[model samples]
Target: MAVVAVSAGIMPDGYGSDRCWLNYDRGFIWSFLGPVCCILGINAVLFIIILILLRTALSQMQHGPAHDKLIKMVVFKTLVQSVIVGLPWILGFFTRSSQALDVVFHVLNSQQGTFIFLLHCVLNEEVRKQFRSCCRRMTNKE
Candidate 1:
């Protein structure tokens, strides 16, 4: 799609094109359609993964507490991933480049890492227990 847009002169070159900046230009809307479609495609894939996870979780719901926790974690991760990946792209469609938006974009970009760390390390009971044990060992050494 991007290659076609570029070849058709609808999209600007990455380095040499003035349209690389966040201003409107001729064919800009058509050019942006490529990335817009890409973003939408990504969201669609994520949605499918979320649906699969939900279905699997539902089927395992009557199994036990483990499945309950897994389901909750999967849902939380899916929501976080969507916001982290989708929000900045959606906002970019509205705003031009700016200090505030740049900061926000960076923050949103990092949220996936933070959320994953929290989900796997902080929220997991087993990881928390290991972390606490390591802390105790360190403190005892001190």
Candidate 2:
């Protein structure tokens, strides 16, 4: 992809085309920096919420049974989903288009948006699991 981007002359001269898509033209700082930082900030917030929910579940679980297996499964699933969704944008970043960098920026933005949605779904599922467990415990107590 970097080769393609270089051959297409999208990257300025002297820059190593071997760099990862995200690293390319990153020196501009202001243009790509702001958006990347914003996306990461949002992701961090969502990640924190996921962690809190997971911790709550762990705290609620009975010591008789280890929930490590379930926690690992959820974490693995989330990681796989994230990698699958992110692969395309990573590829796109390396490949340069004839369109201006603005187009690339928009494409990256859209990819980030999609990732955010997927992240939300992942977090929502964790929250739902916690809710279900709470309801089950309440019903059992009654």
Candidate 3:
């Protein structure tokens, strides 16, 4: 991606057009390469941050059955959350603004918001404890 950006004459000022792969006119190259490089750079940074977070979480879970379980749960939840949160953003990248906004609003105002709220409630220790205690008498379990 970086190669494409650089070769397409996308670099900032002081980076001459002579370095580009194709010898297109300066104005044409600038107009075509600008947005592509900008979007690619933003996506690269976001992915790097996510990778760092995952690596840190993995390093912290060194051993123990509970830690292993927690790691698995975290990985699963992260994957699900990524899909839920990123789907709209991904779609928006390829869509016109009006259509993207319509899709975003539909998802945000529907079951997606409710699912996020429920996940938040379930993950809270106090709520989980109360839920467990309430179910214990009914099932002889916790």
Task: Give the range of the ten consecutive residues with the poorest summed lDDT in model 1.
Answer: 14-23
Give a tens-digit lDDT track for model 3, residues 2-91. Answer: 555665454345244564433345554544446656765676577668767976978776688877877776666666665565555455
Which residue pairs show collisions in model 3? none
Tens digits of per-residue lDDT, candidate 2, 1-142, equal 5444554365344343464334345353223445545665676677668877877887688653347766766676556555545444444443455355546655755677666665665456677798799899999999
Q: Candidate 1, residues 6-65: lDDT per residue as tens digits? A: 745644443244644433555555456567778678887979887897887588567688
Which runs of model 2 end up more than 4 angstroms from their true locations? Answer: 1-37, 64-66, 97-142
Quote the lDDT for 79 in model 1: 74
Clashing pairs in 1: none
Better of 2 and 3 by lDDT: 3
**With candidate 1 superimposed using the best TM-score fit, by how many Å does residue 6's alpha carbon deviate from the native?**
3.1
Residue 67, model 3: lDDT of 78
lDDT of each: 0.68, 0.58, 0.61
| Candidate 1: regions farther than 4 A off | 1-23, 29-33, 97-103, 110-112
- Give the best candidate by lDDT: 1
